[model samples]
Target: MNEIEKKIVDQFDVAKAWSHVQHLVEKLPGRYTGSDQERQSAEFIAARLREIGIEPQIQPVDSWLGVPDGATMRIEAPEPIDIPCAPDTGRGQLISGEFIVIETPEEARQLAGKLTGKIVVIPYSYSYPITPEEARKQGAAGMIYGNWGPSDVDILRVTAPQTWTYWGLPDPDAFRIGEQEAIPQGHIGRQSYERVRDLCRKGKVTGSFSANIRSFWGKSHQVIADVGPDHLGDDADFMIMAAHHDSWNPGASDDGGGVAVLLEAARVLHGARQSLKRKVRFMFVSGHENGAYATSTWYLDNHWQALREHAICFSFTDNPGFANAPEFKIEANEELMDFALACARDVVGDEPKINVHRANKTADRGFFGVGVPGIYTRGAFTQAQADAWGGAFLGYWNHSNHDTLDKIDPVNLERNARIRLLEAVRLCSAEILPYDFRRTVAGMRERLEGWQADGRYDVSGTLALARKFAEHLDAFYGPAGTRDAARTNETLKALARELSWINYTYKGRYGQDIFGVDLKKPLPIMNSIDELAHHAAGSPMDLMLRARIRRDQNKVEDALRASIALVTSS
Candidate 1:
């Protein structure tokens, strides 16, 4: 690496980085999807990216963060009760009606009597979380739920140090009461639920609910910036370093820390542009907390072709601070599991207990929808802390108003950023790509086997598909040296491994094991590799392509869902 690259890589000032992130916390007023708070946050990021001499762009999004017109609920049995409800960023149609009572979904199923003018209530079950989904399943006009389980608060805190980041409030949206069936709904905690349930038990039970929501169509933005040489030739592939700029919760541990790391890393990279062999693009995205991934979705639609041809994607967000939790872990691109291990070793140096696992099947990477592999670093808290306060990985406070700068520790931010900076630099500057194949293949085979055992799939076709992919994997990695051979070998191997993970792990069987696809897949996965890859040699085109893929992968997901539905039906 040249002097400039060295200096840029070395410029991660912990204190200044923390200050930058701290300042941003005040600007983020609420959930990332809607509200002026989110818009201001996006603008600040764009300004910073522009200051770095990179063209910053804005993207309009349908933030479900609609202005709350109002909502009310009334029960006309025994004693009348009034309840409060709020609009979720993930919007649902307005609904108002009397509530209908059903014993179970099966009972509700048998009594599928017209509910166009009624809300639905089924007794709470031990499986309360899934109960709303069940209610939606039963074709209820809308849901008025009473929980049987405890509702606990989730707390998040981080101790990492880096640049400025915005912390904002969580979306006040209700749970997935409607995503499954476009129904309006509301839930009451266990304590309050008992009163409602007791009243329902009385002979005459009647309830009415109504919601009025005001929403505006506007644009949001995703900012992209770059560093190092502009023309690195077709043979080079960049390692993309990324983070989502918007937040839910003050977003301190959730991503303010991650954003700080990205800015600090970018500052270093921009300062030392000459030594980079490949390009490094920094992406600050919005819409992560709502719309699932509006910004990344937009990027994929616009830039996926480039992603397919020239890049490796990496992303960082969420709590990358304190490491004293049960086990500070790293989720890696399964195909390059060993490669990630090698990089991690370089940064923490023999921290044997830094548990590493396969990617969580989805995150920002899945938006790329292809074989692009990425990682979701483990939350920064210990097991005990996670149990008590909820760790960095989407705790109760994640999108709540609780995500503030006060929850973060400067020391934790500094350590995590330094680790990421080193990782990114190594990847960007390395001569020989370090992505591993055998281990990834092993992981895939294991996954395929599990799917077969589940009997939920027609193993024949999917298994055949898996074998073909494995063959491609073997062919891609066969070449040992020679520039073209090595480049193709490395890139294809990495792509195949990631694609394999995306196809098999992200959706099919592996994803099913982890609830539904509630997470964006591409960006987070890319963030995992961005830090280390940049420290070595990386390609900007590669980074750009990943950004595009991060935006485009949804098509694949849609297709996959269609195909899977067909298979299951057959």
Candidate 2:
């Protein structure tokens, strides 16, 4: 390592960062957005940024904060047994209904038509959200979500708000519950859920759910720190270091570790600011856990003009010290994966080969949702977690109260900080942007064709255009030996600039956050196609939907056509 790199790396104290993690997780009540603890965390982060010679900016955002008090569930008929309940967004009213068990999504789907008027019990370990919207669509009156982990009956925040309208914006004008328009809901532990299911097989069971909760208007803050601003003068591309500071509990793994790493990494960048060719940004966002993404939403709205001009982001999260699963899944466009791996390797020994996995919903979702090229760093996983995911994954005490300071490994935390910091540094200093959209283009084409093969919908036209787009990509990228930095940077930026229009919400607003779409879909356009593919072949009533899809397809075609012209013209 160079003198500056070594000095900055050595300057980072994992113990000191862990101390901050302790303070954030244990000393505070919880990091729910708008809470005093959350705001204090913001101040602490701001103070740290100032200590490192960067002024922190706190963007004001307004929203409603939901504070769940307590809840109780009891099986009345089978046996008068009380089941512990986790509070949801149910206004704390007692609810009574016939209990039905849907332990899996497949089961939920199989019984969707029969779930009407019953109090449905479903697993919370869903890859996709199994919301009260589905429950309501199926005619369920009340719902109970079962815990996944064996550890404890975890308390959960409002489920529906996660869908879009309520949670997508950092600060929404009014407090909107979930997009699912949910009925009364509560959660149960696995053990309790199993007992109820066993009782249900033997005979009919009746249950009641009740909770006392409070909601009120409140505000939260977004903390942003800039490093390498001198280099980011007009015309230079920039990068963002991102993580969420808010969590349901201590949240050491979910984000406490990440926030620690961010602080230290920002310090390192601050010390070596002159070395960078681009500006480096650090963002600590609130409304991540409970409010859907109030901070990100407000940011998209308030800073659209400036942000629209920026290019890429580097996101970090889930830095659990538990080294059970050595592999980490980084969500990046296929083109950026190699650079991402190289960034990780530059930091440490690089023994365990980093693995790339599809994206998931996280703090970085905001950047990727808007078509900004970004990468997500997952926390280490346990063997159990590895098997549970069946691939490279992250499963730290996500949203659980168990994510305390003690769980953090000082060494691992430091390594993660170096990985993130060095990655940012490398990206900022690199003359040419490290992204190649050819892979992403090919991947999208393959996905479209794959879905078409299933006879779900015919995407031949889109597939053909994808090939043309790939040709354009090859032409723009040219042979590496023959291309110059300016041309490469311009070409990639133009590609991102156009692709975003295809991937993001209409008019470039954060409107797509309102949908319950998978962030791991690789291509947002595919998510849209997938969202409508099955329905497109359904009843005649889908004419409007099909028409809309046609319009979307037309837009996709137009964007691709324009992108090709932009690339070839230069």
Candidate 3:
């Protein structure tokens, strides 16, 4: 590691971070987005920024949020038995009906016909736990949601509460639902699911629930504080180091640990700010748990010009620390990832297995919508390990009350802090940003190949473009390091910006983070090409379908050709 980065790494203290997380998780209750606890959490983080001598700014975020009242669910048959319902915001949403249960999407597809005549019961497993929208077409009354803990024990899960799109943000006339719109729903524990499922096998099991979930317009926030010189050279680019502060219950691993790393990152960088070559902005964003991506989205949309001129975001979430034995990942092309990993390897000595995601999914989802190149990192474990750790499948403690401060280890926390700190330093301090577009070309090709395997479509159109882009990128990253830094950075940014617009926005513009575009995973641009080809050949309406698919195929082909020209000609 460079002398200055080494100094910053040595300065990081996980103990200090632990104290902060302890206060955030232990002293505080669940910090759901827009809750009083979340507001206080923002203030607390801002206060810490001040403690480190960085003036903090509290940026406002508006959202649609479900304010909880009370809820109850009970089985009327097989003798009346009460089942605990977690807090939700479906005011006066009461229902009584027979039910259908599903654990995975395949199961739901298999039972689609049966699912229509009853209340759909689904377990909280993947990111989405709601009854599939397709179920409504059949005629289901509503839904009874069940949450299972890592263990076999029944776990009560309270979801991030936002009914309308963009979490709780105000919507346009066409966009507004006017109220919480969905099949009326409430949650029960795992044991409740087993009981109801067992009774159904014997005979019909009818159930009743009253979801008194409430919601209103409330303010969420983003806390941004920077550590570095006020003025930088014209060529110098700034970097954003980010993590979410709000949590469900004591969200130690879900992001309390991540926030702790950001805190330590700021303090460590603050110490070496003068010597550093570039500016670093430390952001603790909210509205993640509730699904708005409120702060990150606001930043991307509201500050587009500034971000476009010069900014790359490095976001942190759900860090499992060293003990979790989690994997490291980045969405950028290979050169950038390699540079960052080399920096990380210098410190922790390769204990972390880092990989570059070919087709990006969830991570700092806020930035991609607005065209900023972003990198996200986290610590994760398998379901078995997560279960043992009292963590849900996706994270150690995703959205449960059990994610307390006890999950943290001081030494491991610092190690995580080290990985983030060094990467941010390199991005900020490097005169020429170390990014390569060939990785983008390569990643897209990989996704296309996967899609080809999934469905038989002639992807040669997309494949041809990927090859051309690859050739140009190879020319840009010269074998002798003879490329101009300024030109390379600008070209790479432009490519990523266009790619983001096409993948994440409507008409290559803005839309909802979750609904507007694919947030967790950005599918291939020609994702359905092969499927359309196969359908044209196999379907009864082959003539019409082929004609229509050809038109779209030509349009996408032209767009890809244009994008290739941008890099190739430049």
Candidate 4:
């Protein structure tokens, strides 16, 4: 290891850091998003950053900060069946009708004629959840949904009142149908629904339901923060570290963990300002739990120029406590992969036991859709524990309220924090930044090709557009060094910042109907940016470039396949 790397390893304080993280975790429950508690938590983090010699800024978020008013759901049955339901966040209107039973898509197509004005109950398939858009498109007035399992304990019953999250994406057609202000929806357990289906197959299965849901409530907020070196020169780039601060019931794993990591990062980096060669900025975001609309969209609009200058952003989130369990490799922007892998070596050490994902699935890294590569560091649960509890199979309490800090292991958190800290420091001080354009190109091509292979899209035109975007990336490459470092750094930072804004907006508001062209038409631009991230390390991009290069590249088939992958969950 290099002299600096060896020193960083020596300075890592595992036990002390663990104690500090525990203290922070204990104080987190009081800081649920949108409440005064949340604001207080932000202040505390900012104060800590200041003490470490870094100036912290609070990025204001656009949010509806208040208790969601009345909610309700009801079945206006001729003879009521005792089933439970609740008012989803933003619901409206109430319409009553008899339930129509359909067993297959064929049945749905046939019943479409009569189902338009009636409620519909289709058997729940083992794969895929029932989506509202599909039901609406099929001409159903209301829905009686069924899931794969029985109703587990309803944890929401005990959550602190006045707590709520972003209810899906914003929609003007949104409505509610229930006893209180709730959506007109209900779910029957797997066994109960199967029984209902059998009864319907034998004969008539009819029931009526309605919901009196309320209209839209107050607005929501999105907070942002920008702090870094004032001058790194025009071509000098930056390393961005980010995470969402909001939560779903204290959101310990989904993002509370991420917030804490960023806080500690800012503290350490700000304290070691003299050794830094590149600029560092930290973003403590909100609304990621609700789908990243407010912060992601607003950032794109308000600071498009700044984002274009960002080098790369590292995202920290989820139950870092699972580090002791089976190791899943790091799948990140290829340019950043080596840095991540190196940090893994330094922090994770050599291990024959676990796999690492370099080109892994995307997270907000996917959100950086603009191609600026970023990393999501959340350790998964032990293989045995995960297998025993299917939920744990996906790393436990994903969106559930049980994501408390108590669930985290101090050793796990300390290891995760060290890896993140070293990665950030190493990247900032590296002689050559670590972005890989070729791999990024390959990744985008893969995504496009995957979409077309699914047979659902005719996006050949997008491929042609993608190649053209690749050219823009080729024209932008420049050499890095200390003499030009100051100017080069500023240039890189400006571009990273601007790229961040563009990608944020692009991801948040891509599919929305914008001006005639559907603005998201430029997805390739962001994809190309991710390619540049891969070029960061001094290593030749050629050897590592073939990882995702598909020999059979078909645009139409690839586009369709990519589209389907976006919808179907594994």
Candidate 5:
């Protein structure tokens, strides 16, 4: 580490950060989006920033928020019973129907027509193959997600309230092209699931499901602060360090830990502002839990021009210091993976390998559309813990009322802060933004080859472009650095932006995808390539699929060519 980085690390006070976490959990619990508590938390974060000599701006953003009131499920047939449950999302309506259990997507497909007017029960999954919207479209009255964890543990006790609305916090002015009717949704524990399932096999089963959720238009707040390079021009490049301030229940680990890290980092970085070559902006966003990243999306919309032009990269933190979490994980876009890992190794020795992954549609990843590469670092559960807990990376306490101050570890929290602080300091002080596009091109080529081997649509054209781009990148970063530092940095930034957009998003640069859906595949725009093989050639469906693939291929090619142009022109 450099002198400035070491100095910044020396100033880290985990006790101070722990105090912030305590305050958020004890004084400001239940920070639901757009609620009074959420606004108060925003003010609290702003006050903390002000205390550190960073003038923070709290911007109010209007959005749709869902607040859970209560939920209940009662079986009325084959033996009357009241099953404990947790509400996901609904409009405060009660409905009763014949109970139907579907264990997998295949079962749902087979019993599609038979599910009309019935309450369907399915296993809860992170990537829902059959979403609530599909159940609603099949004329189902309500949907019940059975907990996927062990039978002994009460999953409902730790599962937080979630929304089934695919398009979380829809655009107020945009029209819903094919919106479906809202359906009541709730979750049941494992033993409850077995009881309901066994009862259904004995005789005709009937149950009532209701969720009292308050849905309305409301306002959330974002606290933003900029430090370093006071005289920099409007278009001057800057790095973003962001974390969500609002969360479910006590949220000490979900984002309370992340907020503590961000605040402490800001305080330390502010002390070394004079040594930074670029500006560092710290952002605390709200509306992550119930609003589904609405506040972050709002910030992106309001500051598109400046962010697209001047934002060098984005680094976000979430659920940083769980008590029992021993695994350190880093998720980043390929371009930033090398630099981020180096930072991780610098702080936590290279002996314990860090688990690295490509960035996904989580955290405050709304910057993907704007072509801003991002990295998220957090302590995670070990494989044994994950397996025993039904594969929950953040443990069952995530987003739950159990996510309290007691779940946080001071030592782990301080380690996380130091790693992130080192990242921020190096990013701010670097001459050329630390980006390696060679990894980016190589990843694209590998994905294209995998698709080609599937014997699906011809990906050769895009694959060739990826190969060519790799060649250009190789020449650009030879043994000795280039003489034109300014041009080199600009070229690297432009390439990173375009390539990141194509690799992660399908809505081009302006639209937002639905929340809670998986879009982690390479070149998401062309993800439908495999579907083309299922249809017969010259059929209408086949023709439509081909046309869509061609269009998406053009998008990929345009981005590759743009990257090549930037590299060659520089």
Candidate 6:
């Protein structure tokens, strides 16, 4: 690290950041969306921003949320027995049906006709092959998610709420199904899951599940502030640093640590504002745990034009600074992977193990569809540790009452904050933005070629476009040093917007995909490539897919052409 970088890193006070985390976790427990505690947390964050001479804007956003109250489950068949359970954010109601364990979505589909009025028990994984909406459509009466962790008596899991609409909670379509028609859902521990499975092996098992939750539309606050020069005016090019402030059950690690990191980074960056060439927008969003990124979605919708025109990149922090997690994990888009990895190596020495992954559909990732390249950094357990703990990410205590202040380590917290500060300073102060489109095009070509090898569909034209784009990247970046920095940066940003739109989103630039649906594949629109083989040629389904592919082909080709035009024009 250089002298300036070292000086900025030294300015981050670990004690101050830890104090913030302690305050949030201890004084304000249960910072659920739209709750009084959440509002107070926003106020607390805003006050901190003001203390550092940055005026904060606390914007109110109306969102629909389901807050869990309590839940119950009982087996009322041959022998009456009560099972311990925790409620997901499904609707509140009592429903009884025959207990049927369907391990996978395909199994549920195979047993479609028999699923009506049946309570389906599905095992919990990171990504669900079948969602509650699909289960509802298949005529299932209720749902129970079997926790993936150990059968320890202390652990009870409640996951983030299920949302069918895009960007979560704001869409009118999400409310199209009335509460009367909604299905009740909850989670049972592994021991309960084993007992239920054994009971199902017997002749027939009848079970009753109920969840008491309060679902309503209310207002939540988002605290936003900017640190840097004002001379660039309204269309100033800026980068975003954001974290969600609301979390479940004294969520010290899930987001309290993230909030603390953002605060400390902002304070340190404010002192170096005069050295920055671009603005740094700090957003403390709400409604992540319960409302599914409602406030972040609100910002995207309200500021769509500005974000598309001037936003450079998006960086988010979540679930950082775990006590026993020695491994550093960096999740970034291909465009920013190289830069982000270098920053990680700077913070944690190059000798330590660092895990690199592609960005996914979590951690307030509302910026993806907006065409902003993003990066997320966190401390994570190694593979062996994760396996020993029953595959929990941070720990089995995640999103539970056990996520208390004891889970945070001061040393790890300082390391996380230092990494955030380095990334922010370099991104804001660099004369030329650090983005490599070559890496992006290489990934695109790989995905397209893999699809082409499948022989299910002809992606030759798209593959050619990707190759053509790749050939021009060297020439595009060759003259960057001698060119006008502002013009060159603008061209790169515009190209990124187009490439990210096609690479990350299937809904194009204007719409949002349904929340919690995995779109991790490169060029997610082409995911339909495998589906074409399922239907006979010239059948209705096949013809429909053909039409959709043609449109998507046009989308990809047009984006590549635009990218080419950008490079050549610059």
Per-residue error for 555 in candidate 5, Å, reads 1.0
How much is the lDDT of residue 198 in candidate 3?
Answer: 74
| TM-score between candidate 3 and the true structure | 0.85
Candidate 1 lDDT score relative to the true structure:
0.52
Global lDDT for candidate 3?
Answer: 0.65
User: How well is each residue in 1-570 modelled by candidate 4, as lDDT tens digits?
Assistant: 567655654555555455445545566564444555556566766776676666666665554232323333343343345444332233445546656666654565455447666666654332222333455665666666443333343322111111121222333433222123222554444445555556566765555443322332333333334444555564545656766665555556545566666666666666565577777767665544433234554555565455555545555454555534556445564445666777767777776233444432222333343335566554555556654443333443444446566666666666677777777777777654555444444455566665556433334565664555455445445332233544444444333333322323333323322111112222332233233233444346523432322212232234324333321221
Which tens-of-lDDT digit does each residue in 1-570 have in candidate 6? 788888888899989999999999999988988799999999999999999989999998988777877889999987898988888755657889998887765676577668788888876766675677777887888888877666564366866654544465544555666355567788887668767878887769997988777777887789999988756577788899999999887899988999999998889888878878889999999888777688888899889889988888788989889998888888888888899889889888877788877777676786777788898888888888777666676787888888998899989989877887888888888888899999989988999999899887899999998898888888887864568888888888888888887888778787776665666678886677766866798899899998898898889899999998898888
TM-score of 4: 0.64
What do the candidate models score in CA lDDT, each in turn?
Answer: 0.52, 0.67, 0.65, 0.48, 0.80, 0.82
User: Of the pair 1 and 4, which is ahead by TM-score?
Assistant: 1
C-alpha TM-scores of all predictions: 0.67, 0.88, 0.85, 0.64, 0.92, 0.94
Kindly report which residue stretches of model 5 are placed more than 4 angstroms away from their true locations once superposed.
Answer: 76-79, 98-118, 137-139, 147-149, 157-169, 172-180, 190-206, 533-540
TM-score of structure candidate 6: 0.94
Superior by lDDT: candidate 3 or candidate 4: 3
Error of 2 at 133 (Å): 2.3
Prediction RMSDs, each to the true structure: 12.2, 3.6, 3.9, 11.0, 2.7, 2.3
Summing lDDT over every window of 10 consecutive residues in candidate 4, give the lowest-scoring window: 157-166
Worst 10 residues of 5 by lDDT: 171-180
Residue-wise C-alpha lDDT for candidate 5, range 1-570, written one tens digit per residue = 867688778799998999999999899987888789999999999999999899999998887777777889999987789988877766668889999888765676678778789988876666665677778788888888777555566657433233344333565333232223667788887678877877776778997988767666788788999988667766778899999988887889988999999999899888888888888989898878877677778888788888878888888988888887777899998888999999988888866558988888766687888888898887777878877776567776666676778788998898888888888888878887889989888888888999889876789988999999999889888764555777778887788778877888767667665554566567887877866766687889888988998998999999999999998888
The most accurate candidate by TM-score is 6
Ranking by TM-score: 6, 5, 2, 3, 1, 4
For model 2, state the Cα shift of residue 103 in Å. Answer: 4.2
